[model samples]
Target: MKKKSNKQVLEMLRNMAEGLGQTFAPFCEVVVHDLSNPKNAIYAIENSLSGREVGQSVTELGLARIQDPEFPAVIANYANTFPDGRKVKSTSIGVKDDSGEYVAALCLNVDLTLFQSFQAAISQFTKIDEKEVHEHIEAGGNHSDRIHARIDDFAAARATTSRSLKPADRKQLVQELKKAGLLEVRRGAEIAAAHMGVSRATVYSDAK
Candidate 1:
């Protein structure tokens, strides 16, 4: 074994993760084993996860093993025919100690389902191909769609923009509104007068 530098070790781990992510493309892959039976597989890697997504359940992930079948046998040894019916591309390597005894099974989950979903969506769009689309839904919109989506996403209603903006943000928003000739109504008597529940004089007095 060669002595690896800290930077080299970190870079190696990063490259491994990146390669795994790419090779496991359209699916998630991870390595975790049962706490009770360290040699048995229990957890799967999920790459399709994002901001608020939680990991799936044993049943949801098809990790539940029947009395006759077990996890390590099901996923770790599965060469083909996953219950989900998708073609699984996976392999499991056992981690061992100095004694050469089985310690844990590293499991990898591939993301074929998400890729299929994206394919369906891209087919719906028809104008664009799946490869050009974002792997994440948040990245939706084609080159042409993005031109207007940018404008639509950034455009905000005055009432909402007014209520949320900070002092500086508010000032900037006001300037933008003024530039567009929308700052004609200040948030004082004029606003109250527009509501028609009170006169401009009462609204002015109420401001004090």
Candidate 2:
């Protein structure tokens, strides 16, 4: 049985990426590469509203995010744009191969020609529904202790000494305190007191 060369494998990978873009696009391009020697790695820039340009490297474009440690894969919200005044969006999802090797990264850049109209029409409804859902969650829960703990966290993250009863501040505090299980879905006043290093009486008093 014959086996494939390095060139053959790269080509196969490229074809797969480009085909995926055409099949599922706002999806303008598919970028693939190994960072070890990224200069030599190939990409399949396919199904482009710009044109079907293929076979390039990140080096060729003067773009160098192949080495960023923190953001190995990111979804660029509004990073891509189109000719004749349409818009595009791109996101890259990185994954290791079956052998646990951090192989190639796949970036899917999609054009938003028809997608934008649907987005515009439904955006108002989406926002309204989300606000209503959040309101419902706020009304149903007996989470006063949990909420105050998070308020403390928000203040700490921002290095704020001043405390106010603002919803935004409360939300931020909740996110920061949430790590200590303060804003947890289930509230236990006794357990919360233990975590806060405070008296249970204080917790009950604050519940009012």
The candidate scoring highest on lDDT is: 2
Clashing pairs in 2: 26-110, 26-111, 27-109, 27-110, 28-109, 28-110, 150-173, 154-173
**Residue-level lDDT tens digits of model 2 in 68-170:** 4444444455366655666767666554444333345566667676777889879866774424343334332546545555545655667663244344543
- Residue-level lDDT of model 1, residues 79-197, one tens digit each, is 34246566545555443333333333345645356667899899888875547654533222242243223223333543333234344543443344344433234343344233323
Reference-based TM-score of each model:
0.28, 0.38
- Least accurate 10 contiguous residues by lDDT in model 1: 50-59
TM-score attained by model 1: 0.28
RMSD of each: 15.9, 13.9
C-alpha lDDT of candidate 1 relative to the true structure: 0.40
lDDT of 2: 0.52
Off by over 4 Å in 1: 1-19, 34-44, 48-78, 109-208
Which candidate tops TM-score?
Answer: 2
